[model samples]
Target chain A: MLIETDVLVIGAGPAGSSTAKHAALNGSDVIVIDKKSEIGAPKRCAEGVSKEGLKKLKIEPSNRWVIKELSGVRMIAPDGTSVWLNEEKVKLPEAGYILERKVFDKHMAMDAARAGAKIMVKTLAKGIRREDDHLVTTLETMGEEFEVKAKIVVGADGPESRMGRFLGLKTTLKPKNMESCAQFEMVNVKMEDPDSIEFYFGSVAPGGYAWIFPKGDDIANVGLGILTTETDKSAYDHLLEFVKNNPSTQNAQPVELNVGGDPVGGMLKELVTDNFMLVGDAASQVNPLTGGGIITAMEAGVYAGEVAAAAIKDGDYSAKKLSKYQERCEENIGVKFKRDLKVKDYLQSLSDEELNSIADAFHDIELDTINTAELIKQLIKVSPKALLKLGKLF
Target chain B: MIIMKVNEWCMYCGECAGVCSRSLIEVRENSLKFDKKKCKECTICIQVCPVQALAKEE
Candidate 1:
């Protein structure tokens, strides 16, 4: 079957859904397609989002999607000393939420549908073609193939997106920069303090860290992120090893397991091209420090929707017009992400001993008062020799 | 029998204990104590031990 629309959105995750929601609300005829039959199936996330990020998108905490409200965090050094911080005092007022991601993502898509966006699920986009001034696509739906024509195409297709690749943008990620992760959803576990999230940083996880995000009194999501370049251990291996060794969680019943990666690098130098735009994982908008992408992806979607609407109104689909989306993202969200990457890089450079010592030293400090940069600065203040090893990355 | 012990440097934060599957370890007297009999020898404890204290019995 052949269909035409004002805008075509690929991959109905946060970015695609939000883009469709905004465009449909503005009276643009939009269609979103995803390969999955269901909107939020086969969950592959840590399911944690900062409070400030959700509020920015105007998504309030709903019981259906929110499993718990997180107010503080605990950092465990390699030496075993711990530092705790109240998230609010740190200026992350909405600090974060341990969400039921499947529900949350599905609901976001529903919001778009309610606003008049037509979604095509279980549809795989085969390839793209440029005809005259329009973009054409051949999509496979439920064993059958179909063609779609649109004036504008938004690629929210995620990490393995082909749309942007076909348009000639560098989509390759270096092993040094990518984080491999694995997690398990556990139940019947007793935590020392269930309300606070926990982080374990050391060489064990390599460039990344391990986390325990409490979902409720007895349920939690435990995961780890490891730098791909540092080790050959798979994320599942890391997660399994941690589970076998930890005393607090050793007694818990294993319920489910999750594995994935976080692309902690910067945004693509060019997320837009002639008549095309990228968002979400496709655009590499994930937060470099935390490997969180829901907030950034949604924010990117909002900008893309607004830009695509304006472009349609003016009948202009050139890269020059879409460049506005890139500008808005950089000014609003990109700046913070860039800074976060710097911090992430710094953290990645530390030795297990150094991480433990830093944790031990900071045990007495108030967490809410220190930004990541300040913490690193303090580490430098206390140890001049350590700073020398960093070599001016600061 | 593998005897897993959390390092004295550990704060009993239970990050490793919480992710364990065999229910072999527990926090007692503000330190990691274990029951090696129930251990499935998964070694999640060794990998996530923030203090690098947990070690297999020789």
Candidate 2:
């Protein structure tokens, strides 16, 4: 089979779907392909997204895909001291939904399809090469080989982006920068507050944190991410230990398992080449501190789609034209990513004692009056050294 | 020569492939492919596996 498109998106995740939708809406012919038989099965996410993030994308919340509407966050220190931040009190935009990604992702693809983008499932790109005025991609689907000639190719292939490497972009993640994650959707779990998500920090996770994002009153996604360089044990080992030790999940039974690697930092310097561009995890657009990328990926997709469509209309597929995508990303998410990476590094450097002290300081504060600025002031007071390390972010 | 092994516990999640310094691994739908000739024996994959499915053997 031979298919020709103005834009070819390699993966149909949130990034690819958004890119296709916007590009197609802008009068570019777009085709999206994914290797998975089902769009969002075997989800690699913890399924948490902030309300502000969805609002930024202009996506209204639907009960069909929202498993739980969370109200706030709780941080647990290494010594088991818990500090709660009520969303109503703190006015935190981070409080939001635990999504059913299996449904949500399919809905995103559906939106793209409705926008005139073609979609192929269980299709994998074998290789790509430069053609006369476009790029040619060899794809395999259902034991059939097909060719796609695209004027612009967008790589939205997630953290392990083979498409990026094949295009001569270095997308390999280092051990220290990558978070090896393992998660289980567990049932029959007990929770102190199902309306609030929980994070456990310190040696238990070592370079990352354990999380419980409640799905319902008796179910939650229990997981943890750890740096491979910081521990000899695999991420699975740490997760098992965490579940066994944590009081809330001790008796919970895992109904599903999800594991993947996240490039927490190290955003690629270049996200485009002649006739090619990268978005989402392929471009390392995730938040370093929180490992959140869904909103950022959608944002990158929007930029890449608009830029690609404009380049198509202008009949210029050179790296110079696609460089506009990079510029937009840098101005938007890139600034925050840089600061987040630094904060992630500083937090990872803290000892368990230091973490406990920081938690203690927050616990001592009046929660009703504390904001992020005030919280940071309290943090600096507790550990004066934090000012020197985190001063640049301010 | 060092070769990487995938045990039965493997989930084909592609974590190993993403971190491979040489990009020597590929995760298909149900199987993992490794290019032993290009491997540098970093063992980073073994450490990153969520299920301890990967190992380095000499």
- Choose the strongest candidate by lDDT: 2
lDDT of 1 at A379: 80
> Where is model 2 chain A poorest over a 10-residue stretch in terms of lDDT?
A86-95
- lDDT by residue for model 1 (A1-394), tens: 7899989999888899999999888878999998776777646677888887888789877999998988778778876788888766665422378888889889999999999999988887777888877899888776798888988899987654667766776654544545666778998767667888888888657788888889988999888888655765666677778877766689877787665446678777788987899998778788888888888999999999999989988899999999999999898878888777777777887788777777777889876666767766888876555565553554
Give the per-residue Cα lDDT of candidate 1 at A324: 97
The residue-by-residue lDDT of candidate 2 on A1-394, one tens digit each, is 7889899999998999999999998999999999899998889989888888888899888888888998988999999888998777764433488899999999999999999999999998888999898999999998899999999999998888888788788888887878989999999889889999999999999899999999987999999999988998888999999999999999999999999988897578889999999999889888889987888898899999999999999999999999999999999999888988888888898889999999987775678876677767888997887788897677
User: What lDDT tens digits, residue by residue, belong to model 1 across residues B1-58?
Assistant: 7676555655443434334444345442244567777888877656543334566765
Error of 1 at B41 (Å): 36
- Interface root-mean-square deviation, each candidate: 15.7, 1.0
- lDDT of candidate 1 at residue A66, scale 0 to 100: 92
The C-alpha local distance difference test score for the whole of candidate 1 amounts to 0.76
In model 1, what lDDT does residue A106 have?
92
